[model samples]
Target: MGMDNKMIVSSSPHIRSIESIQSVMTDVLIALFPVALMAVLLFGYQALITMVISVATAMLVEALWLRKRDIYNDGSAAVTGLLFAMVLPPSPPWWLVVVGSAAAIIIGKQVFGGIGYNIFNPALVGRAVVLVSWGGYMAGNIWSPPQPFAFGADVAAVTGATALADQGEAIQYKLSDFFIGNVPGCLGETSALALLIGGIWLYYRGHIDWRIPGGYIGTVFIMGAVFGGGFYDNHLMTGLFHVLAGGVMLGALYMATDMVTTPVTPAGRLIFGIGCGLITMLIRLWGVLPEGVTYAILLMNAVTPIIDNFTVPKQFGGVNKSA
Candidate 1:
């Protein structure tokens, strides 16, 4: 009897998809390429260099922290690195890149027990830390104006504010320029067209659901029309501007939809998105800062577990307690 072997049984969900962490992360990198390409095209080779340095730094930090030689091969560190870089101003110094990358992997991700266990989005955490630590590079007088493929020393040395940064009525950007990504801003926030292309590609591949982005953007559009842009040109353009102007497109499509830190249930996802939109507009309209996508999404990420608990659906054959 002691020599007899017994089969071990495990929990149901006994089934699984063929997809691995590597494949999903690879798809995310592919989706981000259009935005990265647009960043380089608008900002110059310096933008590309920042992205490379950030990615390398993230991979190195994660490898060293976890003592896992294959960490880079998972593609997660690369995704975090690029996402972190996309949010930075064009051509920040190499030290900022290294520091933010390490913080993202070590503090933001690994400290929370890595990947699936993290409460906040690691890239956003990294960005928030760096933005606070080095406000000069993130804001103030360090931004390089878009050069549009000009890689020479023709880079703009003078500091300038983004359109949102200038809250005055006399903002100088043409709507077309912002849409096509000609204005100066963070590497990813400048181009709505590029982000949309990448977002659509991700959606078509079934990598993301429509509910989260739909809720977040729909709420923003409504709020913008109700509160912003004087009624002159049908007011729709004003609403469109809110969606296109800053990181709304990037946040709604990519960061807010992070599967690891967001809700799993459909209704919960909608609530999470709406909550993000509400917080973002509140900050943009009334808070001191011009943009609020990063903090808004991170806040909602902190609430995702609660959202899931409240939004859990009833079982197929279960009767309501009150019934």
Candidate 2:
């Protein structure tokens, strides 16, 4: 009876779950598979090449640097590599793929103390570095135009500016085109349908919540409708365009919702998403860049800790205001 009455304490880590890091990474990779497949179907062999190179180099770098015999089993490097490739222009030279993958693992992940310790998303860190270093390759006519549903066919060598880059009287894309990925942009970001499929998969697995993306996409829709061109004639259409075009869909779902970089509290997550949208729109409109998802999410990532600190809920039974 005394033994039962006494408090029982086991060693640390008593609570456990079936989920493992490998399982989580595997799910993310699986979710990414359709998007990656769409990238290949639209952009052709160049996309496949870039993905392979990035994955290989990222895994190699991580294993060599850490001297981990089973680094591949952890599955972080593969996810980072695939993500880095997804954000890049599909037609980059082989050397660029190697360089960016190495940078992602070395500077982005390991330099910040690896995996969970990195402040910014590791994949975005690599992409930002590559973009800054080789602006000509990353933007300004480097994008390979998507060939609509032309799977297993020869991808014609064509280059075009993205829909977001066209700030004339109006952007030159229908909602259907964006949905079907008949546009020019990064390999993975062009297809709204693909991204939604992946995001839905993640959501179904209970890996993500809608709040981050909901706040992000909602803010962009609202802001674009108010300040965007052609809103007077077609407010609803204009709002839909902003939501469908460019990297907003991909960024809101995949990049901004990164578990390690985003906030822990619900309010903080919403605020983070809103901040990302605000910065993204500002850069897209006033700033020189046509797309701002990368920098916006990265900037918000830098402030996640502060957001969490202030937004943390009060303890369960203590500090009652009406006590």
TM-score of the candidate numbered 2?
0.91
Deviation from truth (RMSD, Å), model 1: 3.4
Clashing pairs in 1: none
The TM-scores of all predictions, comma-separated, are: 0.91, 0.91
Candidate 2 lDDT by residue in tens digits, 68-127: 887586898999999999998867888988898899899888988988899998889899
Residue 227 of model 2 has an lDDT of 68
Off by over 4 Å in 2: 1-9, 12-15, 149-156, 168-170, 231-233, 317-323
Displacement of residue 106 (Cα, Å) in model 1 is: 1.2
The lDDT for every candidate, in the order shown, is: 0.84, 0.85
